[model samples]
Target: MATNNIKLISPDSKLLQYTQIELKDPTDAYLESCFAAIQQNRYTIESNTLVQIGQTNKKS
Candidate 1:
């Protein structure tokens, strides 16, 4: 496995980002679990298609 440091630049701004530290072998079940976790949890809609993590609602 490898680690990658990412940077984002916007007009007048710069930010640092970190990718996941662990990489798993790909599989359908793994994908399903990930999607399921996301779908079942609460999320706050930041926009039409964007959401902030850790902002999930308890009612979900």
Candidate 2:
């Protein structure tokens, strides 16, 4: 199953409509619901010392 025919023109070029898309598969999930994980980080290391704090956008 593969089909692709697209033609959309305008701006004095007329003929502005025609589309049929389905190339059997175009990478599913497509980003698994888009994406909205701006920034997230949590770290803590003992003994040797290491710490990071800058967490927001907790997805709520």
TM-score of each candidate?
A: 0.28, 0.19
Q: Which ten residues in a row have the lowest lDDT in candidate 2?
A: 31-40
Clashing pairs in 1: 42-56, 42-57, 43-56
lDDT of candidate 2 at residue 10, scale 0 to 100? 63
lDDT of 1 by residue, 1-60 (tens): 232323445556643333333445565445444444445554333444434467545885
lDDT of each: 0.44, 0.35
Candidate 1: which stretches are off by over 4 Å?
1-26, 42-52, 55-60
Q: Which lDDT value does model 1 have at 46?
A: 45
Determine the backbone clash count of candidate 1: 3
User: Candidate 1, after superposition: displacement of residue 41 in Å?
Assistant: 2.4
Instruction: Report residue 38 deviation for candidate 2 (angstroms).
Output: 25
